[model samples]
Target: MVDIPVELPAGPETVTGDWTVGDREDIVLIAHGAGAGKDHPFLVGLADALGAEGLSTLRFNFPYVEKGRRMPGPAAHAIATWNAVVAWARTQEPSARVWATGKSYGGRMASMAVAEGLVVDGLAYLGYPLHAPGKPEKPRAEHLPVIATPQLFIEGTNDPFIQPLEQFETVVSTCQNARVAWVDGGGHSFEVKGQKRPAAEIGASFARVIAEFIRG
Candidate 1:
């Protein structure tokens, strides 16, 4: 196993990420969400699980967050950053199948990149924000159906970012190679009230699901 940090080129922002390379010929590259960086405990936990499964994992931060911005950077910049990271990961394991994975906003941007013809073996979305909370009409799924790469979306039943399960189902149904996993009683952050589980455990659970999906 190897942990390496690489630089991200996005103007004045210098972003770095942690990577663990296993002896396998498959890799999963993960990007953090809008409100956090690569060191987020959830990501760290998922990385641990993936490492144990013998699949390499790379987790990175976007330009905005690297610059200390709370909000996400523009779509063009996010896609560009992801492209750079993907390219770097390819250099690390040229023989490995490269899969893109992310949480929330990061996942959405990965979809956008796929739509724009960025090659990848698959995609895994930890919590896809199908639509903004209480704003179901403003969907963030126009490009999802067009992305042909095998995709997995793990969602929480109580997530406020996506509502009306029927709508999300409809979107997933249209995809040729898309699957969904429901985390019972969890919210957008995968926090289940009264369940009292640590974030790391929840993330590890989802990581196991992703490992299974990739293995299949």
Candidate 2:
């Protein structure tokens, strides 16, 4: 894994990322959720698993996480960070196809960036927070229909953020290229009910599912 520090266009602060190289010409750029950094165990495990499947991986922290804050910064900053890291990743491997994937908040920001003209081959959401917990009335999916790139949402069956599978289905149906994979009995983090597993194991388990989507 190579350490990469990305400098924002409008600021002096640099966000850190870990680049796990693979033999193939595809790369998955991953970002953390609101509460965690790039080095979180789940991300590390996912990166490793992707690497083993011959897909390079780049996992990075958003600006707020880099600044030691628990709450995420504005969407603009997060999108800028995504842009910077993606730009940097292209420089490292210009021939590789870059795709974006992230947990909850990170995934949402990636979608927003793509909606606002950031280019990517595709997108994968680990656990898309479709709405605030317990409030499905306000779904954050207005941008879903406008995005033309392929999308894969790996959501848990019991994730409160996207309760009532019908709501999520409706959103996906409007997209040009979108699909959803339900994790049976799992929560927002893909943790299954009454099933205890290490963070790494849980993260790695989804590698095959994501790889298949990317390969298609």
Candidate 3:
């Protein structure tokens, strides 16, 4: 457990994180989605799998989660948290590279942080929520074009969040450097229709691809 300090407008606040040390020299910071905290089984499985791949992981909670709120706080708050967490990771392992990844909403916030100049080696989105379901007209992608770091968007083919895939592709095309990985017959949560799989297993399944993307 680690306490990361964030400077919010109201005052200085701290969020908790779990640091899973690995034998490797690189570390990845994992953030949770809007609906869950860092302890979610999916994130735990993802972190553990990454550790097995010889990579360290620090999965942390955003301010809202710490405060017991169901809704996400301001983007500025999330961005500030990102800044603090990355700084902590770099200080913890000065020589090691740091990468940022998150599930859904969390991943979008990381992208926003990088766009606004939070440094990290690369980024991977477990499922980038391009827009709300049935609402592709309002894409959350303007900042994506400005982010220079390598981005990997692991999306599900049937996810309604990115319905009418062409719009999502158009958004990806504007990025300076980006890659997309589609999960066949997958939903927003990477849950395949009529196929039963544990949440942790789904998360762990992406470890190899994520590791490969970060190394490439």
lDDT minimum window of 10 residues, candidate 3: 20-29
Model 1 TM-score on a 0 to 1 scale: 0.93
Best by TM-score: 3
Q: Rate the local accuracy (lDDT) of all candidates.
A: 0.84, 0.88, 0.94
Model 3, residue 36: C-alpha shift (Å)? 0.3
Tell me how far candidate 3 lies from the true structure as C-alpha RMSD in angstroms.
Answer: 0.8
Query: What's the best-to-worst order under TM-score?
Result: 3, 2, 1
lDDT (Cα, tens digit) per residue for candidate 3, span 119-184:
999999988999999888888999999999999999999999998889999999999999899999
Local distance difference test, candidate 1: 0.84
| Poorest stretch of ten by lDDT in candidate 2 | 1-10
User: CA shift at 201, candidate 1, in angstroms?
Assistant: 1.7
Pairs clashing in candidate 2? none
Candidate 2 residue-wise lDDT, 38-122, digit = tens: 8888998998999889998889888888779999878988888888878888898898888999999999999999999999999
Encode model 1's per-residue lDDT on 12-47: one tens digit a residue.
Answer: 344578878784588888888888888888888888
lDDT of 3 at 61: 99
Q: What would the TM-scores of all predictions be?
A: 0.93, 0.95, 0.98
